[model samples]
Target: MLTIRRHLVDAIVEHARKDHPDEACGVIAGPAGSDRPERFVPMLNAARSPTFYEFDSMDLLHLYREMDDNDEEPVVIYHSHTATEAYPSRTDIGLANEPGAHYVLVSTRDEDTHEFRSFRIVDGEVTEEEVQVIDGE
Candidate 1:
């Protein structure tokens, strides 16, 4: 299961809405090995495509350096789907690099509703997981 704060979940949804028509992508970093998402880092979708998302290469490189300096690891790797369900696509599965990270997908297919789901993608396999949103940070 992926245990996360409510506020963080809200932030991700907000970001996804703000970038509707184009997929929004980002990372939530936390203390190394903790698996607790503490810091939200919204990223630019380099692809800027409604069907896909790609983190800017330079931005991703910088984030990795910053995380290393802070002894942090990406606990959550998230992206929004503007017109699809909250499930990983074949491309998404192929691109999953962080076996330990929670892969979050938020679907903004409906104007008044959205679907939020989490998954574990390791070695080209995907497994849906439960998400427990808590009240506080």
Candidate 2:
């Protein structure tokens, strides 16, 4: 299961909605080996396409350096799908290099409704996971 705070969920959804028509991509970093996301780092979609998302190479390089300095790991990797369901695409599975990260997909196809789901992709296989969004105090 992917356990996350409500505020984080809201922030992610808001980002996806704000970037509708173009996919929004980002990462949530947490302490090494914690598997608990604590910091939300919204990223620019280098592809700038509704059907795809790419992190700028420079930005991703900087993120990794910062994470190394902070002793953090990306616990969650997220992106929005403008016209598809909240599921990993073939390209998504191919691009998932972080095996330990939760691949979160938020579909912004409808105007008011969204389908937020999490998945684990490893060795060309995908596994749906339960998402438990807890209220933040």
lDDT of 1 at 17: 98
Top-TM-score structure, candidate number = 1
List pairs with backbone clashes in candidate 1.
Answer: none
TM-score for all predictions?
A: 0.99, 0.98
Q: Worst lDDT window (10 residues) for model 2?
A: 128-137
For 49-94, candidate 2 gives per-residue lDDT tens digits of 9999999999999999999999999999999999999999999999
Model 1: per-residue Cα lDDT at residue 136? 80
What does the lDDT read for residue 129 in candidate 2?
A: 98
Clashes of 1: 0
Q: Give the TM-score of candidate 1.
A: 0.99
lDDT of 1 by residue, 22-87 (tens): 999999999999999999999999999999999999999999999999999999999999999999
* Counted clashes in each candidate structure: 0, 0
Candidate 1 whole-model C-alpha lDDT, 0 to 1: 0.98
